[model samples]
Target: MTTAIIKPQWSPLTIALMVMGFIIFWPLGLAVLGYILWGEKFGGSPEKAQAYWNKGKAWCSSNAPRHHRNHWNRSSGMSSSGNAAFDDYRAEQLKRLDEERARLDAEIDAFHEYMANLNKAKDREEFDRFMNERRGSRQGYDQNKPDNGDNNNGWGSNNA
Candidate 1:
């Protein structure tokens, strides 16, 4: 029997290496820890290592988040779940949900448009009120000025 160089066991040398790896870079430390944990599966022939890799890949895919799994399923089209009635029900429900989402999106757009129009009207009203008040103040000031007939056009003459 051939003995492997680095046996997968907790030794002082391995621990020290792992610690050093961490001090150098974090991913290096993580890689060292993974080797310490699962290096036995990779020490054999290529076929054994490939089999272990495939197993780990399968485990990761199976444990992936629901949204990611659903995205894969959607890209591949609907797969049969072994029962026709259940499949039909699921398809119908998905279609209904999609239609409802579209309707809600349209409603949201309409609401944003209405709010924009309302804001514009409010701004116009405020601007009109400000203009009217400014005109009124200017007319009151013109009425209050005494009519000096020298025709200086509101500028006092040098004949003071």
Candidate 2:
């Protein structure tokens, strides 16, 4: 017959801490702090950790609060409105990114068409004319140059 040894009976730290805590603060301290810490080090699963934490929570809720109940309520669970807001912001950012991607795609398509048109250009004169047309007509300079003379009223005088 093969005996499959369970983990709890073999942990040395649990025994030591349990002894120390038992000697110092008796059952309450051993169960509360020492056992929990030991269990955290050597315990199997998240459920056990939660159990330890739940024990502490139950103690605190019952003993600490005078009247208020810590039962499941609308506002009892962990709030993630901040995260939800962040998610909304993230969605908006993704939407903006999609819009930008579409715009860039359109621009790329237009650029490819322009390049194709340039390649099909008849001659050097046609290419030069096309470049000049794409550059657009330059704005005519203002012929009326302003005379730099002190002709304004004395608005800078101290009128206080």
Candidate 1 error regions (>4 Å): 1-71, 154-160
| Root mean square deviation (Cα) for candidate 1 | 10.6
Identify the candidate with maximal TM-score: 1
Clashes of each: 0, 0
- Against the true structure, candidate 1 reaches a TM-score of 0.50
TM-score of each: 0.50, 0.26
Each model's lDDT: 0.87, 0.62
